[model samples]
Every structure is written in structure tokens, then in C-alpha cells.
Target: MGVLTGRTALVTGAGRGIGRGIAERLARDGARVAVHYGSREETAKETVAAIEEAGGSAFAIRARLGVPGDAETLWREFDRHADGLDILVNNAGIGTSRPFGEIDEEEYGRLFAVNVKAPHFITQLGAGRLRDGGRIVNISSGLARTAAMPQLMAYAMTKGALDVFTRDLAKVLGPRGITVNSVAPGIVDTDVNADWLRASEEAWQGAAAYSALGRVGTPADIGDVVAFLASPDGRWVTGHWLDATGGSLT
Candidate 1:
């Protein structure tokens, strides 16, 4: 049996990219995963299928975040499949490639709405359903710590808020033996970054050079870090920001 044989995990935005990697990893570790998607139901189904094909358990749930009653809608669907929660991976998010000056009110509002508000309320409502000794892992980014790109200021701000949420939530849920932490990744090659990252050798090398490891990160790298935090091995580590950036900050 794997380390998380009896656990139940919910991974938001598991339809694609980093979230898909995390969902599959958790399932492989023996957790019954709930793959949450915003609009890509088909992609979420693909993630669930991949997990099952690998002898893991997973199901997909659809709920668009950043809207009215989004958290409520998500839990309502969650209740249909599972009775309790053991792990919650808040990995759903959006990035604004727009520069600071060009970001409109609607764009900024949507960023905070989906990245900040959705996760905040999702955790709040999920707290009651999460059993004692459970885990909460927030997928953050390196931009929150370093201003590497000025164009992603708003995106960075959202992650910064999430980091704060991780610290504060960890304390609040400590009594229940729940551990809350943030995992920040740097220059990961996900579908979202495929266009620019694969555009040219120069673009690829430039992104790779940002990390001390001299290579761009993969979704699995971030997934494994999250699996560690979700397992018993990470019991004593809570309320901290983990730099899974391949030494990018260094």
C-alpha cells in the first residue's frame, strides 16, 4: 500500500498543467482524488482516467470559481462523491501577462476573485469536512517572493496574498492537527508556458538559466513536493513557505 492509501484529496484545476500532475501523483500515492475543474470537464475526465489506468482512484468535479456561491457549489458536488476530506490542494489559478499599466479593473478583480477569494472560502467551508490530521497545500509561485517580471505584478500579488493565507490558516487549524503550507514553483514548463518556453532556444535557455539547477522545472517536480507535504513525512512541517523553485531564488 502507498503512504496515502486511505486518504481523500481534492485538487482544484486538475484538468491540466501543474494541477493535473498533482492529482495523478496523489492518486498514485493511494489517495482517492477529486479532480476539480473550472470549465474543462473533458480534461478533468482525462486526468481521472489516467489515474485509474495507473491503478489509482480518482473522480472529477466541475465548479467555476470566482463567481457567486462558488465555494458552496464546489462542496455540494464534492459531497456527492466523498464523505470526508483528508487533503486539499488549492492549485487553481490564472496569470495575467499584462503589464501593470494595462491591467484593467475587471482583470485585476478576476485575478483576486479566482486566486484569492475562491481558495479562501473553499478552505473555510472545507475546514469542517476535513478530518483531524489532514493537510492543506497551496500551490504558490516564486513571483510572490521576487520581482523577476514586472508584467506579472498582479499575478504576483495574488500569490503573495495566498502565502499570507497559508501562514495564518496553519495557525488556526493547528489544534486539529492540520498542517497548512505553501509550495512556490519557479519557471515550470506547463501548458500555460509552452508557447513562450518552446518558442525559441533563446527563450528556453533564458528561462532555464533563472534557476540554479540550470533547467526549467516540470509539473512532476512540484507534484512530488506536494505529495511529501501531504504524507506523514511532512507532519511537523507547517505554516511555512517551501521553495520548490530549483534554487531560483539563490
Candidate 2:
């Protein structure tokens, strides 16, 4: 039996990239996964199919995280499909890397709505639904800490907010036996960065160079860390910023 046998997990933004990786990994470890996506019905279905094909249980849920009422819609469908939720991965976020001076009100509003607001309320709703000794992993970025990047001022602000949420929420939910933590990744090679990489090979190379491992990270790397956190091994760990950044901050 897998480590998460009989457990149910809900992973948001699971249509593709890191979210899909986390959903698949959790299912593989014996958790019945609820793959939540926004407007990507086909891609979400594909994730579910892959999990089912691997002899794991999974279902797809649809909700736009950045919009109003999206969190409730997600939790309702999650419980409807998984019967109960034991793990919640707040991985859905959106942002744009623009120069500080180029940032506008509309951009900031949208970025905050998706990156900060959605995860806040989603975790609020999902945490209440979690079983005893449940786990909540918030996906953040390395840029939140290292003041090394200037172009992503607005985007970094959202991640910085997530770091704060992870720390504070852990205390609030500790009494209830729920552990909240953040997994901050660096320069992951996901669809989120595909367009940026396409715009400049030099930029991609620069990203790789930042990592001590001399390579960009893959979604699976982040997924594996999240799985460990959700498993029995990570029970004693809470309210920590687990940097799976390939030593980028070093």
C-alpha cells in the first residue's frame, strides 16, 4: 500500500505544469486525487485519465481560482468527488513579470486576485474541510525571498504574501492538527515559463546558472517534495518555508 492510502487530496491548477505533477504524484502514492482546473476541461480530464490508468483514483474539478465564489465551487466539487479531503495543495496562481515602472493598476489587481487572494480564501475553505492531521502545502516562488530580481516586483509581492500566509496559517490551524507550509521553487521549467524561455535563450541559460545544480527545475521535483510533505514523513514539519530551489539562494 502507498503512504497516502485511503487519503483524499485536492490540487488546484492541476490542468498542467506543477499542479498536474503534484496531483499525479499524490494519486500514485495512494491518495484519491481531485484535480482542479480552471477552464481547461480537456487538460484536466487528461490528468485524471493518467492517474486512473496507473491504477490510482482521481477526479477532475473545474473552478476559476481568481474569481469570486471560485473557492466554494472548488470545495463543493472536491468533496463531491473525493468523499473527503485530507490534503490541500494551493498551487493555482497567475502573474506577469514586468518592470516596476511598467506595472499598472489593472495588472496589480489581477495578479493579487489570483496569486494572493485565491489561495488565501481557498485554504480557508479547504482547511475547514480537512480531516484531522491533514496537510496544506502552499506553492510559492524563490523570488519572494531573494531581492535579486527587479523585473518581477508585482509578481514577487504576491509570493511574499504567500510566505506570510504560510507562516501565520500554520499557527492558526496547529490546534486543529492541520499543518500549513510553503514550498518555494526556483526557475521551474513549466508552461508558465515556456513563453519566457522562448523569448530568450540567454534568459533561460541565466535561470539555469542561478541554480547550484546547474539546471532548471522540473515540475516533478516540486511535486515530489510536496508528496513528502503530505506523507507521514513530514508530520513533524510545519510552518516552514521548504526551499526546493536547487540552492539558487546560495
Model 2, span 1-250: residue lDDT tens: 9999999898989989999999999999999998889898999999999999999998898888777897888888776666567999999888565788898888888899889999998888776678889999999999899865788888988999999999999999999888899999988888878987657989888889999999999989999999999999999999999989999999
Number of the top-ranking candidate, with lDDT as the measure: 1
Q: Which stretches of candidate 2 lie over 4 Å from their true place?
A: 198-203
Using all chains and alpha carbons, the TM-scores for the candidates as numbered come to 0.99, 0.95
Residue 223 of model 1 has an lDDT of 95
TM-score of 2: 0.95
Q: Report the C-alpha displacement of residue 158, candidate 1, in angstroms.
A: 0.4
Report the C-alpha lDDT of model 1 over 1-250, residue by residue, as the tens digit: 9999999999999999899999999999999999999998889999999999999999999999999999999999999999999999999999655789899999999999999999999999999999999999999999999756889988999999999999999999999999999999999998899999999999999999999999999999999999999999999999999999999998
Q: After superposition, how far is residue 51 of candidate 2 from its true place, in Å?
A: 1.1
Scored by Cα lDDT, where does model 2 land?
0.89
Q: Pull out the clashing pairs in model 2.
A: none
Specify the highest-TM-score model's number. 1
